[model samples]
Target chain A: MTATLTAPPARGDERLARQSAFSRLAGRPEIGALVGAVVIFILFFVVAPPFREAPSIATVLYQSSLYGIPAVGVALLMIGGEFDLSAGVAVISSSLVASMTAYQLSVNVWVGVLVSLVVALAIGLLNGYLLVRTKLPSFLVTLATFFMLTGLNLALTKLISGGVATKDISDIDGFASAQAIFAQSFDVGGVSLRITLLWWIVFVAIATWVLLKTHLGNWIFAVGGADASARAVGVPVKKVKIGLFMTVSFLCWFTGMHILFSFNTVQSGQGPGNEFLYIIAAVVGGCLLTGGYGSAVGAAIGAFIFGMTEQGIVLAGWEADWFKFFLGAMLLGATLLNVYVRRRAETRK
Target chain B: MSLVQLTGVGKNYGNITALSGIDLEVGESEVTCVLGDNGAGKSTLIKIIAGLHQHSSGTYEVNGREVHFNSPREALDEGIATVYQDLAVVPLMPVWRNFFLGQEKRKGLGMDSAFMRKTAKQELLDMGIDLRDVEQPIGTLSGGERQCVAISRAVYFGAKVLILDEPTAALGVKQSGVVLRYILQARERGLGVIFITHNPHHAFPVGDRFLLLKRGRSLGYYRKDEISRDELTALMAGGAELEELSHELDRGGGGVAAAAAKMLEQESKELGITPGSTP
Candidate 1:
């Protein structure tokens, strides 16, 4: 009726137009986060002279890596349409497990690290299994897990070691090697960089490849976008969700090992509310809270913005108390920018 | 031989009879339309054929061989594909991604984006849908174009029998017409196409054979030559029972009921059915 009731053209539909290369780049999911990052960086550059130094930039990167590593997992989970509240405490839980196991049994720290990996993954599996079997929202399930991990981290640590923190394991066998792999720093051009900085870049690159160049990546988006449609098309919705939950666990374990080896001690109460930081980074980087439209690079950039805000204030001679307020402001600003850019991209052409 | 044939098919849910005594035959290059209202066992029939459910009684033959499908995967393995309305493609993904969604071409450990992109564009072009860019998200396409993508994907995957469950059930006038065109396109490719819809106007134009169903039983099955469009409408609208309702309303004296009765009366007249006159 709309096409004059004539026969459809055997070629070229008029409703679609080939967008220009520059316009397509502007339409990418990370564009908003990139813009936000640049704005924050330039803001700090103008206000703080020390922020321009190479060493100071290295410090900012090191801080961002800490948040970025977990943000990777959080970004993937959010894209798959779930989030983990237990992630912050879960990292501490891993470190506690490793430190206590090595101190109590007098085994090598590597043995403790391996055991922590298993425990971390189990926690993730539980979160996934409960979600799939009960069909409850991931919010409630992970919130409950967050509280439970917090309690277990404290009570179990107290019960085993009689203190809120575990004994230092720097003197344990394999401590030096484990520290080298997980917490050691390398110097480049008179600037020292943590190994996690390298890991963060590598992980982000791998995630980007999987998302754009692999079938599993497509399934992840499909499952998050419309799981019922994914199921109808024969995609394994349950396995993908469960696997995502486990992936968060695996990354948390890596993050936990860094803490244990670097500090040589485990503080059970240290990481209570850090989950929000990871989530904030993901959201600021342009991950939709509802899932299905996000990128890991956006999340990494979000973490960088976070690191810059927290450290930039200190360098600018501002009170550290203003960090939370600034972070909240950036998150709101970035999310609005993302929504605006997304609509423009879709409406263009 | 028919690509799909169901003889005396029936489905019973414990004591409830969801569908019964249903017979359908779809052959190569033919469009078979299943017409029904809500709760008319249309979905049950689609399910049985799609392998989501099995018939409690009767034989389901594929190429003259009796077969029962335990799941959609099994049905798909036998070259039977069902495209559900509103659940065909992932919206956020690009058109090419949705086209090769579950069936991506793998290059060692990764999807061959180069090969798949070229093939998806070529495949859509072959079906006469020249999209501007395969990189754009599939959700940007109109409702009708999305359905066409699903239909073309089924054809490309070697689906010998394509079962569409209300492809135009949620579309607008022009969009529905667009989908109707693609229905003919699938039939032209020599696939047995089963089109299900509640609108007779949508079905009668392209349907080679019409199966009018009500409640859980078949009202009648007729080839295009055996049933005229008016007869098909009357049959789909409850044939003799509709004539009784028209008279009952006509006998309700006056007021709002009289106005509604007048509309129903004129509708029956347009279709050449004299209300209260059909025996």
Candidate 2:
């Protein structure tokens, strides 16, 4: 039977306008982080005299750039509603492999980096496959990978360095070439910033584009949101989940190689506890643990906040040990705030 | 020729027989009604035809061609579409998106966003559903609206034989009325409709033939012109015994309640309500 009530001609436009208004008013986490970043910067500038300097701000962004690259990958995975605790440990594992292969094995840097990436991707794929197949919690699977890779990092480093903390790649054939590309700095407004900041920006742009503008990005949200519904409608749930896991792993390797090439030295203890930090950045950036909803740029801004605070605290003449306490406090506060923000946005509709 | 045929079909879960010795047929452009009580193999018949379950014995045919379907995808490929009570529509998604879910249009190396929305709107409007906003979440629509959207989706996908398990089972009078209209519309559009419902009244008006089932065995199949609605309802409710039971209830509880009960019996008798008629 035909419905007696027909929709108005302007109905589609009205609904779209309403949705856009809701999104604008709800303020996605990334936008919140941008606002928070300004607040944090203003607070630090007012409290610490040196923080107002262009050189000091550039230093914070330069340092933030390093952690920011890994955070972008972490955020994408988190948005898909999975975790990779192994990422932190993988950093050192991948860096050590790349450095040792290049300096110790006398291989080319690119070849060494490729080997490291292959290993990381393998771990990620195995972890994702097991998680999807068994339907087990990701925390346990990635935790196991974290410890296993952590052990491998130490064992391999010791095998090559003979009990040393780090291996010197200073005289390696490609050391200068690698350093020029990864570690080189340029003067901008009398403040020298590492080239890694540019890498961080590119990562943020690409990650944001994929999450918002592409079909793969849509699947990422659906896979994390309600997998059963996604599968019922014929979305390839398992394949998408596995692919996201591998993306996280590959990104971790990429960031690790960036560090190795920048420093011309590799240490065994490089990335051990950094996984938690990356997760913290993502959380502060407005990602939900429950999956299905999050922002990639929010996570980048989250990394920026951490980067600023880490260097900002020192600029304010505070003891570095207190940085942990500050980070813990911010993560808890941001999570609580994110929960409130998300609940309001969802319920408003 | 039969569009779908099931002969000696049976299904078992461990030791429990969900269906047994089922013989059925659905012809092109004709509505076939399959009636049975709960646990009398109604679900089993639908599942086997829907490709959700396979038959353990006998053969299933489409267009007089014997075939086996291993999955629902295979069934759809052969033009047999099953619409369940739940409808499989994502509530949060827009109507247009849900309509073309797995079969979305693509353009310039990506999903053709404009084309999908435009075609979905046109399809619904053609079905007499005047949706002002195709972008509103499908969940916001009433139950009748949801079923209409689903029926339109099935019809648009080129289903040659549509099997509705219990379309009106969960609906109110007005809502069921809406669905019945859509079924008749589909029939007029030339697709064979398998109207599986216990309600003979719902089937009597539209069905071309009726298959009376009791305890997993077919009582008989009768052409619509040969059987009256009262006789079909009587056969469906186990005939004269139920009429005697209804008459007995009125005399024993004769009061204000008896008056209401008598009124209900009169309505039931006049409308020829059957097992599938009640909620």
Candidate 3:
């Protein structure tokens, strides 16, 4: 017979302890990043008078918007237990395709964006398919995708621009329309901010909601943590993993379209530097390289810190190269702190 | 009627034979104890029954109907659940979450958090897991508690037949008693239970039928009414081998007579040393 087996509810010091422990463990990643960002903020403002201006903050948000949106998607993919090395090249490829279609082939901006997304999706599907079907390490599979896309991006640009760095699409039929939507800027409190900043907030919100509130979220955690166990329990592991890869690619392509429309041109090496940045943001946000745990909001915070330092270093009259050094130190420190706190939370005494 | 029956089952792993020509039947509202030494095909048999591995040959029937399961899910879908020694549960999750890991209830495409928490509490309460807090990660619970949670989960998911793989091996005597009580509870609920263990003492009292295994082959199957505890234990340990061991461990300057007297005393104690015994 079915009997109601009830355990007493957690109360008193136990509940407090659990909450404190969780906050300490889960909060460390963001807290570390935030602290570092504040330190950088103070150092730059004190040393460089120009950094104190509200416009400087707008520039930071604008830069953060471009990198932040893709980082959120990358974080989810990482947490779900896979890699996407081709994500950077995917952005470049999508940007080029969007520009070529809307500016060169005289297609509608929306349609060009859609076509670009489809191409990216196909690449993601192929990557997910090969990795799962062949049982290859995802790192190797995505690395192959990265090299292939890199070659494609370079070859396509050279062919289209006749060995030039990029193709100009100022006179294309959809250029005006794309520019109207993506290139627009608004002044908030006397600070000019790109609309991409708004996009970043929306992206983070949606990504957060999906990570915490959906079945897909559970599968992502399960697949990344222990795929075999997840499969044993009847979770659709392959489908979830493939879906995550596709979402990552979709985000890359979406960001690429935004960049292409904002600048009205696309280059061969438009996104090569982005791969490391996405991973760094994810790692700093507390995503384990081994997978199964992370937060979209934390990744967004990591990007925010990156943006602050990217602009702050230059404004502080430091050589831009120092920014990389700062990032390295910040990443190492944040990663160690996150890993330590997470271990404490997961272990039972 | 039998809940599950394996007819002339055999299994081979590449060059190594894991099981050979085994026949077993489990009846409803009864316990079938499978006792074996290590590498004696105990685990292999469990895997076969749980649908983790298919038998190389033989027919497995549930409720008198032959069934083939391609995966564990298929087996579970047929109201058969397996609770392994380590227990398949995520320790870092709440007890309720572990209860409904892959089978969560959602409303309008989103997780109904309120409902999950409420039901998780109710279900645990229903199953008699008196936890200090359901919100605590399952890792904090004792091994016995965790095993109880797994058993309760199996029952909640509509299990008609439950297979426990070495469920008491990792537990202390007290903890083992708790699990045994739960097994009795399950049996009382009219569910057929398969208890697998190396400990014959634990198996003998609860089992309606005893199947002893050695070297991946069935030694024999005995109904509880037909065999005494000593006979079952002797057979399980390979009576001859155990006597050889007892002689070696005896190491007595007190002679064979003294050794014989000591062994008789030990045996009687094990088998509930009766009153007014004559040597």
Candidate 4:
């Protein structure tokens, strides 16, 4: 009953078109972002001589990775049809927990790191749990989490440290080793490249692979694109969504680790507005704001766009304030391009 | 034995009693058409059989074993696959991806993309559907093609019984014809098909048995030998209403209406319903 077809396979159907290589390329969600990246790369390369140097490339890449690393998780979350506003302050929350737990107990920094990991994952779990239980828009749920984490980050840091930031933990046991993994920079051809660059590339590679080549990746797209359809086909929507939220938290913890190791101190106010930055990077790279249509590589490209504009403006000898205006315009342009690409793909046949 | 049989199956959403007192049977190589207008409990029945909801009463048997499905997965495990009108696809995904969505074939750690893509293209071809490219987003396929893709997916997955809910309700005349062909194909392969639709014109040609549901209760059930196409059409459209409509047309209508009224008179006689009788 299963293997038989009504007819033998045909060689081709003239009514249906064979898509051209160009049209196929145009169908990628990241094509617009790729074009945008190229334009910016050329713009900066020609205008800012300093930006063309290898050392400056490392600096730009380092800055990109800071946003790029967190954007990786946020991209996955967005692709699953949700966004996390708490992602920004959650990084600070992680660092605060790790620092305060260690400072108060006088334990090895690794212990605090471990404690922070648990708490971070809990935040993710709670976000996912609340979403499925209440059936509320993820915006409302993650927004509430954002405010709560913000207040807690400030209050807890001020309460324990009696200041706006944590005490320097560089001298603590396990500090050197932790810093080596999270903050070490290696020189390449006399140019120091931040270790985060390596980590960011690796994270994006892994995320891209999962999204394109795994059953879980397919489920993530399914749950986000059309959840009822996914459920009808037996894709577990709640479990997948919750898992996506937790992925975001795990990255928040990782980002927090990098911040702490690189600076040896945690500021209560450091992470307040960075959540929007990660999202912006994702959107700039070609992730749809609505979910189910973006990619990690796109978000990484978006972060790279951000880094280029930030550094390029100064190197181009332009006033720094224009950076915001330029970025806002780029976001608008890239999104419009994505919309055009999607519409074209849908009508191609 | 019937692959799927329902005796007095029903469902209630709290106290509304969405459906009740329904009977159906589907055997190998048979097409059982469940015909009804909107709000005829057709969707509720599908939900029950597709494992979206449990019937509040009566017995549902698959392969001679009584079963209550808690989810679509359970029903699928029993070799019952459902192709919904519009809900069977995640639009943005490529056709190959949607073809193997929840049940993707894998080679080692990742999806076997080459194999899955080739199989998807071949399966559609086998079903007599010509696709331009399997990599194009399934959303780009016409509505009729999408339904065909979904049907082929069910067949490939080894569905013993395939339930198609309003598969052609949204299609044009030519497009509907395309789907009807696939129904016959599934039947030829010896899979039981439960096809739900309001249009008896579409149902009569391929259906081996017809179950008429009105307002959640069975009007009657008959094999193909027991009813003619005109009788089925008249009954599915609510015979009394069509009879009254024919009478009104007879009073002031033209040649077309007169011919239709004459045809209705014979169909009415065939169904043991006297023409011009008051409801």
Judged by TM-score, which candidate is best? Answer: 1
What is the Cα-based lDDT of residue A298 in candidate 4?
89
Docking class of 4: acceptable
Q: Give the alpha carbon lDDT tens digit for every residue of B181-248 in model 1.
A: 88898898899999999999999999999888889898889999998888888767765566567678
Q: Candidate 2 lDDT, tens digit per residue, A1-349? A: 3265465345354434455766664566666677778888888888889998888888898878777888888888887779889988887777787877776788777777778888888877998999999899999999998888888878867887876355767676766776776677888877898888897898888888777545666667666665765565566878888888888887788778777877667678768778888888888888877776678888888898988888888989989898899888988888888888766544334
Q: Which of candidates 1 and 4 reaches a greater lDDT? A: 4
Whole-model Cα lDDT per candidate? 0.88, 0.78, 0.78, 0.88
Candidate 4 residues A163-183, lDDT tens each? 999999999999999999989
**Per-residue lDDT of A186 in model 1:** 96
Better of 1 and 3 by DockQ: 1
Worst 10 residues of 2 chain B by lDDT: B270-279
Candidate 2, clashing residue pairs?
A7-B132, B198-B276, B199-B276
Question: Candidate 2 lDDT, tens digit per residue, B1-279?
Answer: 889887877777778776677778888788898876676677788888988788887889889998888888889999888777774565545677767766666554456667777878888876767775676567667778788888888889999999887888888988888888888888888889998898888889889888877776776678888888877876777654455556677777758657766766775666565543421
Clashes of each: 0, 3, 13, 0
TM-score of every prediction relative to native: 0.95, 0.79, 0.86, 0.92
Estimate, for each residue in A198-267, the C-alpha lDDT of model 1 and write its tens digit: 9999989988888889998999888888888888988989999999999888888889999998899988
Q: Write the per-residue lDDT of candidate 3 for residues A28-60, one digit (tens) a residue.
A: 435666666677778877888887888888898
Q: What is the CAPRI rating of model 1's predicted complex?
A: acceptable
DockQ of each: 0.44, 0.24, 0.26, 0.42
Query: Using lDDT as the measure, which candidate wins?
Result: 4
Error of 1 at B116 (Å): 1.2
